[model samples]
Target: MNQKAPEVHPSSEWVQRIFDRISGRYDLLNDCLSLGIHRLWKRAAIRALGPVQGKHILDAATGTGDLAIRLAKVGAQVTGVDFSGNMLIRARSRAPASLGVQFVQADVLKLPFKDHHFDSTVVSFGVRNFEDPKRGIEELWRVTRPGGRLVILEFGGWMSFKGFTQWMARSARLLGADPEAYAHLIESSCSFPSGVGFVRRFLENLAEVKTQSSRKIFFGVAHLYVLNK
Candidate 1:
């Protein structure tokens, strides 16, 4: 395994402000940047858990409710939670009136749910943003029922991925996004825990655990992590 990278620091206030500023355009940028493969990546995460019908699923850090919506479409009652009010507002506006999905405002590290409350929990592209990914994972494990699943979709920084994202960041910076934000995007991956490391933590927090990892696009730039407890 790769040696743990030096811990990187990202202020909570800065992260919140950055997302707030980009809330309206977040979905657009995601689709444009990932070439719409993000949706498929999310679907892959959903599929890893087998079926979710009639199960209670929690989409933590569920900006814009994409994964939560997808889960609901599969007959799971989904609750989407995020700390950003503006992002939740956009998610609520686009959500169907009959999807049985509810959007809530809450921090991922300090979720307001009790143990064994959720049958499944999913966080899309949100884990890397956490100030403490381990604690966040533990929280997800805390709320999940025994034998349930936890899925995480986030960017990873392999050697090849580092090179490609470097160029993309330069392009994105030229397009008027705060250069520092793009810089943070590149650096955050290094700070993020890998699939194996995260799985180990989840197993420590929950019951039985399994993990799988898959890459996306050039240079293996993105990673989808599926873990069952």
Candidate 2:
């Protein structure tokens, strides 16, 4: 919710540029599109982190550093890693001065850090964009300390709300999102890892896993996964 503005959706090559274009307009669009309920979803994701003081936190795919800032606010020493240079630039420019947060431009598939380096890791609405989510999940697990936590926030499918799906699609289209984009949103969620599937994936690699999902303001889907290494 506190993430910096977003850019117009763009291809992988234009990742940085796309985020930059939407950076200034990002926050407003999010609130407008989701009716300000994203704040609650973010809060829920952060809550799953429990207490974080003095812990080292990694905010992977930290677009605009919103989760990093939130982690810092809770007394964690936060490091934000992202692939988009412009996104990092905007994060650096807008982040709170005294939060003790650092930003790094790095690929999630190959994080430039030692194994088991962080106490906790987080990614909000960032995994869907990964070229290889399994590799991305592995990278998160790799950098995380044993017994540490990894929390991810992403979209959930609309299957549970079939009656309202059409209305929701129309609503998104009216809110400045391209119809194709909204359709892609629906399709991606349909194929994305479900709550149980995600837990199964975690069971294969992580120590303990817990999950919770919600609909944000009748406009967006939010899924939170907490994995302890």
Candidate 3:
């Protein structure tokens, strides 16, 4: 008999434990599984986020501080927040004192900062891990100053890439990727709405925000969203 896939509960505590367990190898798995293309995607997202020099920015669900490091390198004062202490420890080890990135242990749904505190906010491959994705987004909006932007990079199911996605998902383990983790990721991506569906939901929860969908990456295996408040 075929075995049922394990349920993926993206509660904050559950997600924290998952990252804590995978923290050591998380970066490697990301590099391998995406065939090292995530770097390009991340770079693209950062560029589209506009200038951040001398500004305050938040990198929520900042696993291992890759995005945080990039933001700091560009002269932004970056606060990278993650619930997993282990993940933050790895991030701290990799981050130099000169990098100017602050790694904090905090829940994304209830950010410790005051409202309208950040000049910009960004999350890559992180929002879907939220137990309440909408609430997670609302918190982002709460902290971003007026006229600031929110940028996100996430897995997407593009119509033309249906067959390609299937093939790629099958090829994941061939790259020595984490099979169980990728399984949950693929399931979550497919179930998460994108395009118009995503826009409508975002508009509902966030007031006075403008949104634009960017070109999908690798045939929509991932998507970029820019929301300006």
Candidate 4:
């Protein structure tokens, strides 16, 4: 018996709706699905950013504000942005007032901000969600000031990808998660470029695009790349 594979949405609107529907359980699912290792991965990405005392940072696609909160703690003025309103609401509600982490609803493909506005930009497990990843990376560098850093943490795509991301969706489904949402998720990750290939594309329109550091985590399931603009 042959079963049809699940379909992933092509529209960004469908993606937003999926995130909104699962925004409440997003954080818990992160802890459960990744077995809390995501926190460690995120920390490693921040560490790659080096010192951040008084630096202005942007956390793109910052769902629930986990990475944004961490960036704020390191003395960086952080602005976390996402297009999903429900995700922003959760990020705002969970973020401590004293942290002063600003949560805004915005699309990554076309950010609404002046050029070179941030000292550095960080996206943790988020860049893959952008409808246009190359544009999103360019936009990240656009807001980043000269000598600024861009740190991206995402799932690696150069490995055996068949059924892996789909298997992830199945696991999440067993826990009462949205299979349709994760089917899209798996599809996106499989389609997203990472590490070296992504670096070449990310540096296409930038000057002095330098990689400060690179790391592979969990046996190359994820990668951390820090670029200087």
TM-score of each: 0.84, 0.76, 0.87, 0.89
lDDT value for candidate 1? 0.74
Q: What's the C-alpha lDDT at position 93 in model 1?
A: 89
Q: Which ten residues in a row have the lowest lDDT in candidate 3?
A: 1-10
Q: Candidate 2: worst 10 consecutive residues by lDDT?
A: 1-10
The alpha-carbon deviation from the true structure for residue 118 of candidate 4, after best TM-score superposition, in angstroms, is: 0.5
Ranked by TM-score, the better of candidates 2 and 3 is 3
Off by over 4 Å in 3: 1-9, 159-180, 210-214
Residue pairs with backbone atoms closer than 3 Å in model 2 (clashes)? 5-26, 6-22, 6-26, 7-22, 147-229
Q: Indicate the residue-level lDDT of 53 in model 4.
A: 75
> Which lDDT value does model 3 have at 218?
72
Predicted candidate 4 versus true structure: per-residue lDDT over 98-181, tens digit per residue: 999988898888899899999999998887677667788889988999888998898887434666655676668777877566
Question: lDDT tens digits, residues 1-229, model 3?
Answer: 4233335336677667667877888887778657798898889889978999999999999989998998899899999999999999999999999987899899999899999999999999888788787888899988999899999888775622577558667666665545656666666767776656666765455786866555677777778888888
Give the lDDT of residue 160 in candidate 4: 41
**Model 3, residue pairs in steric clash:** none
Model 4 TM-score?
Answer: 0.89
lDDT of 1 by residue, 1-229 (tens): 3233224645556677667767787787677666787887788778876799999999998988888888999899999998888889999988898997999898888999998799988888788777677788789888988788887777655522666667667666656665555556566765555545645654345445665444443344556666677
User: How well is each residue in 51-125 modelled by candidate 2, as lDDT tens digits?
Assistant: 889999899988878778877888989999988877788788878889979999888888999999999888887
- lDDT rank order: 3, 4, 1, 2
Q: Please report, as a residue range, the 10-residue window in candidate 1 with the lowest summed lDDT.
A: 1-10
